[model samples]
Each structure stands twice: as structure tokens, then as C-alpha cells.
Target: MAEPRLGQMNASFGEGSVVLRWWEWGPADGLPVVCVHGLTRNGRDFDVLARDLAARGRRVLCVDVPGRGVSGWLPRPELYAVPVYAQCLAPLVAALGRHDWVGTSMGGLIGMAMAALPHATMRRFVVNDIGPFVPAAAIGRIQAYMAGAPTEFADAAALEAYLRRVHAPFGALSDAEWAHLARHSARVAPDGRTVLHYDPAIGGPMMAGDPADIELWPLWEAASARPTLVLRGEASDLLLPETAVRMAARVRVETIPGCGHAPALMEASQVALVADFLS
Candidate 1:
């Protein structure tokens, strides 16, 4: 019933090194479940889901992808692409030996890439509110917002309000849940104004690339070998319903009603869906 323990693992990427900060819960030798957060989010986002799974005797590991949260920002910001993210996961996955994966948004994309690899170790794959074929509209929205996000907030209260307004698509999160999210997503700046936890330059790649040029159908097809599950928001502009249907032709698809863009997976019901899938 205690909160998850915190730790960091190092992953080498060429000459530069990246440290993946993670939160661990449950027994040390329990079944491993790696939970990855979305873009602009940190490992703390999985606190609720990790707690639920850990309570059930699963060793849940939630990671803050490089460039986000407490993880060090990559010196070469160009390495912030999906391929690099997938590469970074290689060592962690190998270390786990055998594990299941639950990823949200950008994290889900990373899972898809990992699944496409020749030596995928994931026993069950759950992609939360994302698919290989993301609509350009969704990418545009993300690009526009991240490209010019305000770095300073008057105070923690102001930051929380801003997060609630921008991330309303995460569905109806309680005030406490929102507060937890804001606390993790923000930190005190050198000038003392609260700012988002991630490096602002992390948005550069997205802003520079055209969504039309990004394709992942081959990766999706490559993932057909696994028992994959796709969680889509009913009103999501990111993962189209058609794409979900196509994915369902080879895997399982679950639509979270009244949700759009993404589901935070913080609620008990949402956590239950993942628990059942991975169980």
C-alpha cells in the first residue's frame, strides 16, 4: 500500500548518455509492467495506474522519457524523434528480460516501434489513445501549442489552471488528480516562476517536421505479431476511428467514451481496463 519507490536507469545513445528516471511499485520479483507517459508528461503521470497494478502484485515501472521530467535533456535535440526513443528503450527492455508494456500517446508510439523490432520482449502491449497513423490535425494542434508554450506561471494555482484548460481532453480528472499532474508537470524556475518540467526545445522536432511525411503503418503491421490492444478516445482527433478499426482487424480496440485526444488513465475505471488487459 506504500507509494512506489523511485530510481533511475542509464541508457546509452552513441557517445551521449541518457538517464531514464522511473518509479517502481510492488514486489521486486513480481510480473513487470512498463508504463510510459505521453509527450510533455512525466513518469508521475502513471502513479494511479502503477499503484493499482502493484497492489495486485505486479511490478509496475513508470518512466519519464528522456527530455521530459527529471530525465536529462538530450544535448542533441534532433535525437528527440521516435526512433531514438525506441533505441533508448532497448537496454531497459533487455534488462527486464520479460515484461508487458502500457504506453500513452508518444509513449505508445515508442511501444509500437519496440513491438516491430525483431526481438520484442513484451508479452502484452497496451497502447493508450494512440495509433501508428496519427492525423495531421492532431499533430498540428500539438505543434502549435508546444512551439509557443508559456514558460512562466504566476504560481502553482495558476499553473494547475493552465494545465486543466489545455489538457481538458484527458477527460474528467478530479481536482486532486489535476493538482498531482500539475505538480509533476511543473517546477520552480531560476527566476522562481513555475514552468513546465520539460525542455522547451523538445518541441523543435515536431515544429520542424511535416506530419504528412511521418508514417508508421509498417510498424503497425510489424506489431500484428503481438497481442496488442489500442485504447482510443471516442472523440479523439489523434487516432482516427478508421485507424482503430484497421488495427482491430489484427488486435483489440477499446474506445473510451466522452474522452477526446487522450485518456489520462488516472481513474480507477480506466486503470481497471488496463489491469484486465495485462492480467
Candidate 2:
């Protein structure tokens, strides 16, 4: 069979619009599986996973969420939360009819909120290395890096090296994979400088929100009607092991070792686990 072709969709949100880019593969009429990446990452983060799911006879749609990747930046950064994301994603899902979902970090949170919504479009849900009750210490760590930082990298390689230092937990991705990630995550400037692809101000809403003194169990429980699987990195600081166990009460939980806050499910073995769950 020929290599699966990729398709892009533009979801209108106001006059500016929010582009919904996706990669499609496998049979034309196969089950749809939508993959969502983390806060700073793009839909291409699931290139490997998309291929794996495609090969397994699933139509994978890896979305470049608003404010990340090729997608346009949200003019209202204040609407950066999952609820706002779901508002945009709802139409995309409707266009696809119905589809399963896999999300990491912020993406996972988005999927959870969608599943909770009445008359949701999600068929099944898989959360990669994130949970409802995130630890404050881990939140602090993420906030430190997301705060706009100066980058003097001359090219993509220099920027990749810097990314490797900050996101070391993404695991040892191959050169080609790392190259792919860096290409989507960074852009070369006119003056020989490298910068992250999306607007750093996109993080404003995230940081501006007051700390939640309450638990997010209510949000997580809303998706109880669906078959949900939560994957946690054993070394993840964001979702503490105790909290992961607690989330298990809501759905099946699995722990992947030798990983940190988020585990890049780029490996074939990792993708197999997701395939098995979606099956």
C-alpha cells in the first residue's frame, strides 16, 4: 500500500480561525484515533505513534492544537485552558464523526474534559503521563521553563541541544525523530536566530490562573462513561505515584518506568501498548 497521506482542517474560531492540522493513515474507513501533544509540543509529536496506529488498521489524526505547531496562535491567550481547547476541538471531532483520543500533558487534560462533556464525540480515551491532580512542585518546574526565556541558538541544532537539556525526560529519541520534533517546535528567524514556533505569550493564561485549592476529581469523573486508560511515567514529578494510584479508581492505570513528567510514546513498544488499549 502507498504511504498514508496527511490532511489538514481549518476550524473557524472568530475571523482569524484556528487551524486543525492532522495526519491520516491506514484504510480510508478505519476507526479514527486522535493524538494530542503536550503544552509546548505540536501534533507532529505523535508521528511515530500515528504510524503505529495506522499500521494497526486505525485512522490516526494527530492534531496541532491551537497555539502550537503549524496551527495559528489564539488571539485571546486567556482562552488557553482545556475548556477553551475543547470548544475548538468539538467541531473537529464532529467533522471526523467519532474518534478515539490519546493525549499527553495538556492534551490529556483536553481529552478528559471532552470526555466529560455531554454528547461528547470521543469513543475511547488514553491519557499519556498526566492526571487530574497535578503536584504543585511539578507545576512549579514546568512554569519555570515556560516563562518566556531568551534563546540565542544560531540554528535548529543549537536549539535542539537546548531542548534536550530542558526536556531530557522525553527519552533518547533517534536523530531523525529529534530532528522532526525540533523542526516543528522551532523556527529560524530572519536574523539567524532560533525561537520556539508558537507565541510564548500563549502561556499567559496558564500562569495567570490562581492556584486551585480544590481537587479536579469532579472533572475526571465526568468521563466515567467511557473506557479510559491513564499512563503514568514512574518518575513523573507532575503526577505523583500516589495520585496516579488514586486516578486508577476512575480508570485503568499503567506505569512506564525510566521516564519522567511525560513519556514520549514514540517507540514502537510504547505505541503497541496504546494500540492494545484502543483495541
| Model 1 bad stretches (over 4 Å) | none
Q: Residues 90-183, candidate 1, lDDT per residue (tens digit)? A: 8988999889999999989889888888978889999998887877888888987786678788888888988898899999999999999998
Q: Evaluated with lDDT, which candidate comes out highest?
A: 1
As a whole number from 0 to 100, the lDDT of residue 155 in candidate 2 is 77
Q: For model 2, how does the per-residue alpha-carbon lDDT over 1-279 read when each residue is reduced to its tens digit?
A: 454465666676544567666666777788899888898888878877777778888888888788877676787767676777787788878877788999999889888888888888788899988877886667667777876455556777877777777887877778887788888788766886688876676676557754342257888888756898888887888778888888887689988877786888977778888889998
Give me the overall lDDT of model 2.
Answer: 0.78
Overall lDDT per candidate, in order of appearance: 0.86, 0.78
- Residue range with the least summed lDDT across 10 consecutive positions in model 1: 206-215
Worst 10 residues of 2 by lDDT: 206-215
Identify the runs in model 2 with alpha carbons over 4 angstroms from their true place: 1-6, 12-16, 190-192, 209-214
Q: Superposing all C-alpha atoms, what RMSD in Å does each candidate have to the true structure?
A: 1.3, 2.3
In candidate 2, position 202 carries an lDDT of 66
